[model samples]
Target: MNPILSNLRNITLTYAIWLMIGCLLAALLVLTNISLWANALLFAVPSTLVFGSISASAYYVARSLPMKKRSFFVVAGVFGGTALIYGIIWGILCFFWNKITLLFDESWAGIEMNQHLASLLLICGTLLYLLSILVYDVLLALDNIRQAERREAASEMLARDAELQVLRTQINPHFLFNSLNSISALTTIDAAGARDMTIELAQFFRQTLALSEQQKIALSDEIALCNHFLTIEKIRFGKKLQVQMRIDPDSENCLLPPMLLQPLLENAIKHGIRDLVDGGTIELSSKVRAPWLFVAIDNPVDTQPSSAQGTGTGLKNLQARLRSLYGDKSRVEWRIAEQVFRIEITLPLERS
Candidate 1:
């Protein structure tokens, strides 16, 4: 069934209620040669035709109308068309079946007709048709609004999923590349340490297998993963890399993206401190600032412009992760300042 038609039953009920009103009004003022029964039919017939015509025509307009500004011609066209069509239909019914007009009996069995009564019925039919169409348009507008809201929500969900996919892409390869590099570096150093690093690398892969199963972990867990990540880099770089961490007692309990910090730390080691003979400090801090939690990683600047990459794959991946994990509520900034490279992150205290 058409939604507009399904809605028509309610409109019919309204016409019935208003028909009663029309009957009462007729009883008070109009005293004609017709009986009470004929009088009621006259009013009811015109009311139904007018109401149905207006309601259906208005609903059609609403279904077809655009969300943008509407022209006056559209309103006039629907009202005028409904009035003309239902007026003719109701006029035919009233002119043929009217009992009072047929009451002439033998004088003119079916020859005589009440053109005056037909004209009145036509006028009332036209008026009611226009009125009801306007009412139906209002209902159609409401349905359009609801549909728009659903579409908007669907679009937002799609965009977020795309961002998450991008973040996932960044994370997997950034970690893998570093681990692969470590294995390559380890192949020449202590064979026992190389073997151990491979085992930890395997452990990291096992942890990643559950990524789809879990989107978030406690802040402490992210830190632990970073420690493991650093362990691998430590074996490869040996004593040429130094790690410093300062975690706020309060921030450790909050949930963070599952593998967020490890990538940034890995990036810092790979790009900033690895090539230098004298190692540089890499600092990670978690602190609370009123409504926000700030997790920042600062490392020594790679003052020597090293050209060994197509792009910063780690930065791109981190951007996707930030968008997926915290959306607009979180921010990450990477910059080289005062001979130090820093990646500062701000995430909401979302548990509240």
Candidate 2:
């Protein structure tokens, strides 16, 4: 099917405009005394209908001439082919109309059609066909631009997903190595405690495996995962490791990237709590402020320098992930003062 005929509205609009042009051309023929008013009307109507249908074939030609690889030969070939077809159709129609007029009136037999007037009609039809092709070319360009933009957007999304998967994979091994080391030390001196920690460790890993498949989860679920992790750590630290949580109920349902908080919590325990001889408190807090969700973790740090100080990889990874997921709208910041280390993070509040 022709592209123009495939769309009823477009065909209707094109025909209406062409009909107006036909009326104008018919008036010109009459004013120039090339034909009687009645004869001009009879000629213009059929000619316009035939030319309009032929012009619609320009859409197919436009489709063949892509913007990226358009050439002079291809364009010229299309217009040349169209003009030839139009001339053949116009000649045949005019011959039949002339013969019919001669049969109807002996007075028409004396009047021969002017050669200049015939050439003028052919030129007008060819120009109309060229204009139609130009319109289709512009529309084709816009469609190509839209399709290119969609492909770019899809490519970016795939890259982000791959990066996020790599970041998530990095977290598991780091935490697993530390957990296994603690379990190894406890097996000989405290068999029962080690056994209980093993049970909790198994459960924690099961939950982690389930949640890792998701790209994002509710704040409450993330906190629960962190608490499970703390439970396993508490088995190793005993009464020395204390945790304090102040979570806002309203912010519990806010969504964030999965495994986002665990690395921060791990960093606090490794750098701050583990270095202190007494094993100080870790405080976690979360709140919502309109479009933003705020979360903070505070832990007591030893004033004196220790060999167990973090190498900054975890913090850097957290910052990178935050930037990738939320662009510049989300952030992570940390400060150390008065033997206390505080890390604060801000993220856009998105509901599930």
Candidate 3:
């Protein structure tokens, strides 16, 4: 639906309510003996229609006079100009209408066709027209609020997608550099292993390319990608790099941002296992608790910490991605205690 049409449809009930108020005012005039029922109906119905049509000008006025730039003079001018125009138009309409009704009923002609009655009708019509403008102003305010919220939502979505892309791109160069360096080291010692690793690297990149196009994927698919990454690393480390998985069956189908966990696993391998003489164990686990999915990666680190410290770029990138995707609903935490380095991530569990 067109936005303007949709908004008008939503406010139909408000228009109906105001129309009822106009009818009630007409009844009051008849009951109070101020005017006959026929005269009141004729006056009130056309007055209400004119008020409605004139008030529609408020939408255009509102567009011209933005809230940020609105001033007392501007507002006064708009309302005063509107009321003046409405009074002239309404006065002419009431005059002709009264003249026509007087032709039909000579008694009403004498009673209603007077300067005092004309002035009173003109004043009432102007007031009611101003009231209609007020109603329109309120409607304009509400429409502005709705439009602002929509624009904000669109901007947030765009920012999130941009941040996700940046984080994903960051992963490729860093991981490729490490993988190429590993392949360089293995080529002389074990040609067959390097060849296998190269083939695995090609396949892993192909899968990464496919997954990158999606915003979210099943946990099982992510784990499969991680396993492929570990397979390539295992070629270089052999039995030295041991991995254990304790993923809950129920959490497997939960949806998360694509490549979310891969960087954490890479961090564990580079910081915890790569430095050790007898490469330590990497434990991967996942489980769901109602609306939340919990994933943890743990690896044994050297008793004597390395003199070279990690820059923590991967962890920082992952944290940024989590915040962009879920705002405050998701988080990543890391702790190192007793030669065990652990990274835990909590994500909102969404599934199709």
Candidate 4:
């Protein structure tokens, strides 16, 4: 029921827009001394009836038309058929509607259609049909262009969702392996803290499991997930891993693809901080400036740590997610200098 009403509303809106266009064309009819009110009625009558039919015809044509030769045959056939069919219907309406009114309401003489004049009317109608077909073909072309654009947009969105899903899948195993290793290390001496850490780890994995299928999320919501990730990391790293945040005032209200920031943060923790004897600081910051909002994660990296792996697995997956979301509008990159590794991201600042 809701969808039917929505479709009806859309059709009414399309007709109203098409009728206004007809009214502009009707201005020419008024210049030829058709009365203003009469021109409005007659112009809209034919244009409204014919335009509605033309739109329906063009939509189906565009849907069926092959992309390879979009400019020719199929479009021509659809509009040509529309003009011929509607011109005949319009002529019949003109003929019989008057007689019906004259007989029933006893009105004055009006234009008439009968067997004697049918052939002549069809000939004239065919010429007008070709003219109308030529005019409507322009509209059909425009409709086709808009349909192509919409399909392209939908395709991009599907690709983005697929990328996000892959990123989400990678996160669980990486974090799980790390947490299990931490638990393995802690179980011998500090059994109680290890047990507590297991609880926190459970909570973190619970959140991750819940979020596995989500593609997009509110900025605040993604932050909450990040906080959970940090909570589990905190249980293991304790006072050594210092996490700081300086989020922009505007960005907390924005919507973003889910799990986008966590992978970068995890990489920072794994490679930059935890590998060192004495862990370092991780800072998250964001600020919006007109075209984009910049979010940055910075941590001091130890070059001579026990593990010296450079950029590894999650880095490429993170890049794919950013590529899918921002396409041309977003960026994520890493830089290292003076023992500090910084991950910077710029995203569209939008609200849900």
lDDT of 4 at 221: 75
| lDDT of each residue in 1-352, candidate 3, tens digit only | 2223357664585467557756875797777677876667766665565555555555565556677888999888987677767776777776776677667765543235567666766777667667766666777788889999999999989988888888888987888999998899999999999999999999999988888898889999999999999999999989889999999999999999888877778878888898899898999999999899999999999888688778988888888888888889998888889899889999998974
Higher-lDDT candidate of 1 and 2 = 2
List, in order, the clash count of every candidate structure. Answer: 1, 0, 0, 0
Stretches of candidate 1 off by over 4 Å are 1-83, 88-120, 212-217, 253-255, 302-310, 320-329
TM-scores for all candidates: the values are: 0.69, 0.87, 0.88, 0.64
Q: Model 1: per-residue lDDT, tens digit, 61-174?
A: 555656476678875685687567877876676555545545655332332236666676677767766665666666667777898899998998888778777677767786
| Best of the candidates, lDDT | 2
- Give model 3 RMSD, 1 decimal: 3.0
TM-score of 4: 0.64
Residue pairs in collision within model 3: none
Give the candidate order by descending TM-score.
3, 2, 1, 4
Ranking by lDDT: 2, 3, 1, 4
**Candidate 4, after superposition: displacement of residue 33 in Å?**
21
CA lDDT for candidate 3: 0.80
Please report, in order, the local distance difference test score of every candidate based on alpha carbons: 0.70, 0.82, 0.80, 0.67
TM-score of model 2 (CA atoms): 0.87
Model 1 residue-pair collision total: 1
